[model samples]
Target chain A: MKNKIIAFFLGLLILSFAACKKDVAQDQYEVNPVKLYPSIGAKNKNKTQEQYVSILYTNLFQRALSGNQLVEIIDCLESIGDKELGREVLISNFMNDPQVVLPSDSVMRANPDVFTEQTYERFFVRKPSEAEKTWFRNFIEANPQLSAEMIYFAFALSNEYLYY
Target chain B: MNRRKFIRNAGIAGAGAFAVPYILPSGRLFAATGRQLAGHVVYVLFAGGVRQQESILQRYLDDSQGFPWAGNIMYNMFNGPSPENKIVYGTNQGNGVEGGTPIPQILSQTLETQGTVFREVQAQSAGHFGGLNNLLQGSQVTTQGLKQKPINPTIFEYLRRHGGFPASKVWFVGNGIGNGLPLLNYSNHPNYGSQYGANFFAPSITFGNLGFEHLSNAKVYHPENELDPMYQMKYFLDQSFANVGKGGDSLGNTEDEKQDIKSFMRSTYDRVTQNAIPFPTITENNDALNIGFACEIMRWFKPAITVVNLSSVDGCHADFTGYLRALHRADHAVGHLWNYIQTQIPEMAGDTVLIASPECGRNLNHNPIKDVNDWYAYDHSDNNASRVFTVMAGPGVPQNLSIGNEANPVGFTSDNVPTIGEILGVKDEIMGAGFLQPESVSLFDRI
Candidate 1:
């Protein structure tokens, strides 16, 4: 009787081990990867106020910047400071002011590493005119990135903004 | 790992989730591939700076003599007979162009037969390039310093990649100005050269007509090198199964490598042949070029997106003597193309989504003759120029939607992507920097 009891306990242990193994195996399979990136809501909660402002400015400029929004952009730039040079390069390129002029030809020469041959030409030909020069300068002086974004935003607002 | 071993391990481990298809399922899979619902896109760029007044709307509701001839025509066509003689009367308040610029008769008939969908697509830029970029890219992005190519990919690229279409199947036909390197050519997919594809023969050879024979000749002579690099890539991906027989791995294996090699071989051949052709000629005449391309597309390769860019509209802005004629001709081309799509590819007729909008709204401030150098140079009228008219009609779209006073009616411009995406049952991913997705008000919703 004792021998029978020992056999039964041993059988139970084996079964339990098999069951655990099966469970672990089953857990391994997955379908349609759970998204790698977290949702915007979750990500936003962790960002600092400075980060938030940066995102906002980046987002706005990335669209298009118009002459009208120069003042607001200037304010944003003053707040962001000088550490951001990549952004500054973009701003300086756009300003084309007498103090910090980046001519189209020079810009073409500078952009070999960044812009493709075709893209560089298309952009160079359509430079911002003399009238838009001042607003561009003031903003570049205030902000870090040339905010090439203004053109896009300006275009969008120009088309979307209600005139009446 | 070998696919069989991988599968076995996966099954044994119950890692079925990892085996799930990696593609973000574009719901259009069940769609018919061949001639079934095989459609094309017709872009109607009503150039010649359309004025909100005299074109579509009347200047004053009270003044009887205020209505212009164009306004009277629009009222008669769209609004029909009315007691007040105002076509839209009370309905079209605040929607610019009070008198109503009646769509040319040809387009109207085509719309009626083939089914139509229309929207007042919004744009961000008022300038030609800016507006063109917005429409072509379906959104706006900073074109300033970085020169990282335009952020908004054209519909052509989106359709080719996400829409399960071949690049060769898309056609870009230029009107009046013939064809030049399209300013809107920054797509992430293959771009057809003006000299090749459907319009193989030049004007000198074809006698101002499309040389249909040349299409066959071109295909036969260059059958091995028909597709652009992107199409070659896709075809390679499709035939990736062929590599499995050579005792190679499946996932990241020799088969995939072979496929890449095949694509490269095909691409190199195409690049050489494309450059070999004489610089493609630009023709001012549409005649057979427009109609013939339409028919061939319907009969042979049913393209997903076909852009018929009418340059005469821009010509009008230049005060060219025949601007009106060009406008009329563009109207006719649009009409003819619609007829062919409906009659020949009847399935496409219903399923197709046709969008007719101007590249940019013409300046309301200047007349073509008055502003010679800046004739068309009405600095972008903020959103006013962006508020150009768009008419859409096709399968799975609504007929008439009263976009009544939705504060910020997201009509027109790049918002078109999300709207188109909703119709196509895919995620609208072709967003530009700061391109907030337009509120997806699909034609399906109203229809």
Candidate 2:
């Protein structure tokens, strides 16, 4: 009788374990998505040198938290309202799950040293090759309307560039 | 014989009634509703540690670069200095304790006349959180036994409660440094504590107990008892203030103590809560420029109390790629915001108060990595962070006044709450072993 009772108790414990595992797996599939959109006039349309530079300037001015720039950028694009797509298209970008690990603060504490092309590629936006960043920097500078200082500031402020 | 009789008849009630009329509980003078502004506050939480060697102080001492930004803005504000400009160029004494250089010129020439400045002349605690807590909560507490939560209610609460101010009346915004909500002190409120709705961020707002109306209505100030970072804080504060009565909580203490409790609860609770305001959009630019944009936008809302945390200066301390650009932009933003405030809110132009201070000092030592004063560790523990420069000016304030004595910039504790309270027309209420014990009278008194 004692042996039969012990075996019955062990079976009950196994059933409880199975129930807990199922509960844990129930919530794992949930995904929270962040929105992204094309640049205001970039709806398959090429932008002017001035217009592109302005976009770059806005991006540079608003570094890490670039989403907030949407309101102002949209306001400026009012002249092109007829050409505009849905307003929400501006912020419709696919993002890694918010939980994705990024570089630690200790690694990027020194703002200049940490913001290299390789660092950007590893953590933030897809890493543009150093050559590409340099090229973009130069392009921004040569446009007399914009200066090297302005291009450098844009990169510094870009959310794609600012955060890991 | 007649004089002796008169003296004998002089009762305690007669003498007491003759004391200060301000002490008496006359008819409640509730604030006018139209006079009320559903505005936001842009407090430049200038951290601790500013020496006369840098910025404006340097300008006064013939070191032109000391206050480059202030110099540029002053030049722009006024076509040129008139005879009224009492710009005194001088240096702070050699002692390190006496901040680097003293510039009475800027104070007199620029701040004093603007009537937008609010200077806190009486000094108090000099440590980082010590000075900040005093400034933010309007009460000074010691560094050793600091509570995890605010003991004395904050200004955000009081203004919201008593004034029937909206939740969006006050805001504590930053340029996406991830510091989260600036003041989580309201977490102690029964309806709003740190755990229930501690932070004013997206995640916290989405899950918290705060009403959905606040979430839906970003434009209108929704008065509710929920934990939307924007709404609940204002509601909690406003309600606390409206709840105040004269006869309650005498606490069997002296008349002064009774007054202190009454004032502290009424003012601190109302100001902090009533002004739960909107967060700024972190648009493209340096933190300074972002702060400037928010400050300008906030002028439209006209928050009664605003805390504009300029994060870019911290960028300057790190000497990032565009540090100087960021700093210059920040300077420009301050200038623009000041111009807008003066032009748009003519009522506040003279009556409103403007205060500029730093959060903490940077390492004077040039080295970035090995520099002893990096974020991980630095001089603040000692007195290195003790010395900083603060400027204040506004209506009813004295012009070109220096808090430090003539021998030095006036030396007082970092507990400058009394001065702030005076400017806002609230009495200095918090009192205790650590809180801002009103040492000198109003900061307005120095004006």
Candidate 3:
């Protein structure tokens, strides 16, 4: 009789424990969807004349351009109708300046990968993809006569450089 | 091989030939609908407020300053005699009087004798910018603001889009980049914008001291070894960006055209340094300098349409004496430009059409501002400002014909756009576009 009473008590205790158990919800922290731009082309806005000159001067000289110099450059650009041609001439003029900083051809030839990465970073302000890097590497390797200045010129005059 | 087969094939081929239109270089399916009156046109926006009393009227000081002097200062453009006394609209000759010696005529025959002149044409606007817009857009947008791009498609856009003229083929040589002159090269219209815009050059700023300091020192890369690779890389980059859409506006000059323009710029710089520009004999103002560059452009490009803007006479608001001198020099500049086209550019000698018209006329009465000569200055903002003139000379234009008079006005300032359209074989398209002013019609039609 005692054994039967103890079993009944134990059954009740188990029932109580089972009834007290709570359901655990799946862990799913909600977040809003994010739009991402995966390539260098994410930069879509065109740089104004002032912005272009100022940034270009900074890139070449590794320093800021003076206000007066910036205005003069903008004026020179305004004089020409074709903005690309104007920028081309202005860049060439800057290339001719002794103060312009550029990596030596030997340094560029030693590691085109590094040179291209830095160029992309400097002008486009983006990291190049593997394909882009490989293409530039092969181009630099194949063309023995190509100089660092030419590479910079190409980057500076590229359509990508015109935009942000 | 058989007669029936041959006949069928020939008929089919003929039908195909007739049906399939030839594509022009400008990507047009066919040539302009209307007959091309001239191969080239040189339209001069005789801008800046010009007083009809001082210009077409041949009334010098008599009409303005109460002095008993009356004559034509613009002898090159009009058929009239110079003033007998109080001659103060010419180069100074150190005779203790400013503008004592009149500038000699550059044109052997006056433009009035060579072409048709609309003596009392109605200008759409009294303001300078508005008047300029009327001349360029062929319509007057009442809400057009200053320092803004044209509200409608310009003649440059019309000629380029309809006439299929390349960007390089159409040119706008501005006197300076002030007063929205540069903006007039193209319009902000969605359908016809920079793609069909004229290639502009404000030469005073381009080849001036500022340009010399900045643009003169460009490095000339070898076309094959340097420029080719650079272009290849740039094209690759552009291709990558093309997926994202166009990043900036383009004037639609091809690579070859860009190279040609660059070459021209280099040559121009050399010419500027050597003082070899074909300047007018009395190149004492910015207008004359502008004409010199326009001549250079004509000599080099032989563009299909070239519009030169002259605005030195705008000084009339502050200096009447300066206004007279500038007007006189402007006449000389126009004469020099015409002479240069005839004598210097053999390709455009007989085929080119030359048209000149003032934007607006100055006020009838003078302002309080007076010059050292006690001459009163005039501002444009009255009914008198609506009175202007148009003169055109070229093939298909009736020679020595004069239309309209002070008592009976007979044309609109906006007529020049259609007039140019008629000359360039795009009159039907321009009229069909319906952007013109209500009264605007070809000057030829008026004639």
User: Global lDDT for candidate 2?
Assistant: 0.36
lDDT of 1 at B403: 41
Q: Which whole-number lDDT from 0 to 100 does residue B56 have in model 3?
A: 94
Candidate that beats the other on DockQ, 1 or 3, i.e. the better one: 3
lDDT of each: 0.39, 0.36, 0.89
Report the C-alpha lDDT of model 3 over B294-314, residue by residue, as the tens digit: 999999999999999999999
Q: Which 10-residue window of candidate 1 chain A scores lowest in summed lDDT?
A: A155-164
By TM-score: ranked, best first? 3, 1, 2
Shift in Å, residue B296, candidate 2: 4.8
Please list the residue runs of candidate 2 whose C-alpha ends up more than 4 Å from where it truly belongs after superposition.
Answer: A1-164, B1-42, B47-51, B59-109, B112-131, B140-149, B161-164, B184-285, B320-327, B345-348, B363-382, B402-407, B411-416, B428-434, B437-441
Candidate that would win on lDDT: 3
Give candidate 3 misplaced runs (Cα > 4 Å): A1-41, B1-22, B94-96
Where model 1 places Cα greater than 4 Å from the true spot, the runs are: A1-164, B1-41, B58-121, B144-149, B176-183, B188-292, B320-322, B367-383, B400-410, B428-447
Compose the digit string of candidate 2's lDDT tens values, residues B16-67. 6677343212111344222321122335655334323234332221222222
TM-score, first chain, each model: 0.19, 0.29, 0.75
* Model 3, span A54-126: residue lDDT tens: 9988899898898998887887787777777788889989998899999999999998899998888888878
TM-score of 3: 0.90
Q: Which of the two, 1 or 3, has more TM-score?
A: 3
Query: Best to worst by DockQ, what's the order?
Result: 3, 2, 1
